[model samples]
Target: MTMYWRAISEDQPGPKWAGLFAEYWPAYLKWWLKEGDEVRASYRESQRMLKRHMPEMLPLYDQLCELAGGGDQAARFLSFYCPPPYLSGCSQALWPGKAPVLVRNYDYNPAAFDSLILRTGWMGRKVMGTSDGLWGLVDGMNDAGLAISLTFGGRRVVGEGFGVPLILRYVLQTCTTTEEAGQVLSRVPTHMSYNVTVVDRNRKYLTAMMAPDRATLITHAAVATNHQENVEWISHARFTATVERERYLLHRMSLHRDTEEKFISNFLKPPLYSTAFSYGFGTLYTAIYRPRKKQMEIRWPGTTWPLSLDSFEEGARQVNLPGAA
Candidate 1:
């Protein structure tokens, strides 16, 4: 199946939202129902918390429910309020000094690679990012010069909390700085372990290590990968190289050669960018967020698409990942 990318903008919520979500509704339903009772219970708990704390999101959820046929199944599908599954091999780093930029490689299941879509809409700030099931964002940038991205925090634990995507969405909608985003992240609950890397217009950055059971760990680091101080999920096949990937990024950053072209050249290569197609991570696309410029660039090997707050356009490109069929 060919993946489609569409952009929509609205001043106030309306029926037009349905078409944006309907494209992936079937596949979303199939993935959502495949889970067992335990996962369903977790989703219910997440919904309750979201209702209480993040009431601003309720109306949007209502719109999605009504659009998805207005029932229990539709609500569950729109909620997307379950624990996040483990994904590996994401490397995020901040360019030092003025005019800071954030570059990230989103690696995940090949099946979801084709389902990817980038959403840019008006909220508190002009926001744009890519999502899989269409409920929340995977990575995005807001007009306030804040850029946020996620990676599996390298742990094997699940609890009652919202998925990282929604938390990220909340940050993009509400916060304007790295400190404010960190506070929001600390207060909100998450279903599983994850690391969120946030950079702001002021050149400040933070990597939040978040899980349901513990307090959020805010680290001021230039680079983040699948693991933290040490590799926790070393036994898992996907994270065997977590430490190596982390080291590669840090070593490169340590050289003080902070040129954009150098980093892009390296990130587009092996280890930093995954090509595995068997069962683990595969690099779908590289996203570069320029906080000062208020712009974003989606880069594949040969082609690139640029977007900004003042103007936007919907586009799609067909290309093959390095080692895929």
Candidate 2:
């Protein structure tokens, strides 16, 4: 399947963001309400949760709701509070070189993705990343020279908390350093298990294993795959090869003296790269972020599309991938 990907710049949440919401809402609504209306949180509860946990994002949440026409379902969905269960495969690690760069491969079904790069200046803070659920980010970097990425922790337990993408959005919106990012990640609860990694301009980083049933585990490990401290779900671990991917990354970062180019190239191939689209683990894209330079790039095997806060041109590209449809 060929995906039409676009790079969009909306300094604020207005017409452009609204248009994209309208285009994607129908499909999102279906997914959000997949279990049923009663299973999801109410608009009131979602808003209250957002205000309590991420008060800084309340104003932006209100603005996005207004842009979404202020419907109950849309507002609740925007809040990203305990909604539903979802999962994906991903791997993230920091480059060993002096210059700090965080690289990751987002493995998931392409049909479920927004497939766009969003550059937004919400609340006067410049932020951009691969957008999910319109405003949430699967991975993104802010003007503060901090970048973050997420991988689904292999588990079946679900509890009360926000979906992780919004947590990432909040981190990029409010935090400037890895320390602050770690704090936010540790405090905020997630509905499911997720290993969230953050890297700042100084390259100071941490991986927070966040979940709803327990306290967040903040580890100094620079590399994270699908599972957390342990593979709680044996079947999921085997299916996604979370252990193998983690070993590959650890060995590569320590054993091989790969240059930056070679290190990133490794993620596009086997072990780290995935093609299990039928099982929702296909490698959608490899994202590389240089927080110090304020630059980001979306890379395929042979093609590279570069973007930045300084020169973020608005355009679209067609990418052909396997099993996306």
Candidate 3:
């Protein structure tokens, strides 16, 4: 699989951003569009969400539509407010350091790499993370020294709420602290289940378990995998090892207790860094978000790509993962 990268500065004029959108729109559409009324209905519902709750981002959404020459339809699709796939495999931890940080390992279908994009954008403060197609981010960090990531909340339910990725985009774009971001996550209606981990500049961190039917549950427990406490999605067990994975994270955090080093290294190995590629939950990359320096790093076995707010790069490399065969 091949990964792609793109960078656009906020200082760039609207037209410049439009040009970049134009360049990638076709590829995005080809990969994301599905043939069904359910998909269309979801996009329509997402449009309503933008109009009512997140009107501020409308201008950017409209610009992308104009760039794609798809008018209103493009904006709705890009909103990504549709139902998301049942993704799994993530272990999030609030790393205890001189400056606490957020660490995550995102595992999911390898086919997703076809639409994978690593975006670094500067809108006053730099924002960098991986994006799925032209939609919002799956994980990212801001220059304000704040970072946020998500894991599937291991539930097989879908309802009337926005996709978690768009919500993540909103939080990163507007909130500067863990408390503020937590507030957004609590209020936003997510269509499915998710566990969002947020870490701010002050070393404050939170994990929010969000589902469409229930009020968001905030926890001081710094680690989250594919399930919430006491609520496991029994049916999806084949695809998610939620119980074992969560325990693995908890045990390691307890053992490492005081430093970031021990746990991070451990995450790169079995259980935390998954090898279950055949189940479509392969650990693609482990992301380390360091807000103090406004930097982030993506690591795979034997290789690391380090990035910072001041200097960002756009490139890609194929990764060799366990069970790739």
Measured by lDDT, the strongest candidate is 2
State the lDDT at 94 in candidate 1: 70
- Candidate 2 residue-wise lDDT, 283-307, digit = tens: 9999999999999999887779999
- Whichever of 2 and 3 has more lDDT, that candidate is 2
Native-to-model Cα distance after best TM-score fit, residue 89 in candidate 2, in Å: 0.5
Q: In terms of TM-score, which candidate is strongest?
A: 2
Over 149-253, each residue of candidate 3 has an lDDT whose tens digit, in order, gives: 999888877887777887887788778999999898888888888999998888898999999889999987788888887756676654566777778777766
Residue 57, model 2: Cα distance from true site in angstroms: 0.8
Report lDDT per candidate. 0.72, 0.92, 0.72
Model 3 earns a TM-score of 0.88
Candidate 1, which segments miss by more than 4 Å at Cα?
A: 1-16, 42-46, 84-86, 113-117, 120-124, 237-240
Global Cα lDDT for candidate 2: 0.92
Task: Give the runs in model 2 whose Cα sits over 4 Å from its true position.
Answer: 323-325
Summing lDDT over every window of 10 consecutive residues in candidate 2, give the lowest-scoring window.
316-325
